[model samples]
Target: MEAKDDPAIIGDSEFTALLNAARQQDPEAMLQLIELFKADILRLSKVIYMPEEDVVSEIVLEFLEFVQQGKE
Candidate 1:
């Protein structure tokens, strides 16, 4: 299923809050945000022929690092 079709994804307001919290380096929010999009990320990775485990790990780490950097 597409990301847009995923019922588990947060609504706009909650998404906005999550983004804000992530930018502030809230680890829990960052994790929640990642989990929220995990399926979509995996789907995209598969479409591009990337190994699921490696790609997902790389993406999640990169995202977390990016968010952490923004707070520095």
Candidate 2:
């Protein structure tokens, strides 16, 4: 699908703002970022054969770690 046609696709500025807020540990912005990846995460969950909730948790944990690493 075209990027513009994808609801998960945010404009560059909005994404940067969101990422910044998320990195600062803003729960609302973090949730928004999670929502953006929900579809892809769910799809990954199907192939991984784990509980859906666990899959989501694992990915979110990894994403948060990556974001935290950027602060260093």
Tens-place lDDT digits, model 2, residues 1-72: 457588888899998898899889899998899899888888888888889889889988898788757752
lDDT of 1 at 2: 47
Q: Estimate, for each residue in 1-72, the C-alpha lDDT of model 1 and write its tens digit.
A: 445666676689998788889988788998898988777788777866667888888888887787667642
Badly placed stretches (over 4 Å) of model 1 are: 1-7, 65-72
Error of 2 at 58 (Å): 0.9
| Model 2 local distance difference test score | 0.85
Please state every model's RMSD to the true fold in angstroms.
3.5, 2.0
lDDT of 1 at 63: 76
lDDT, residue 37, model 1: 74
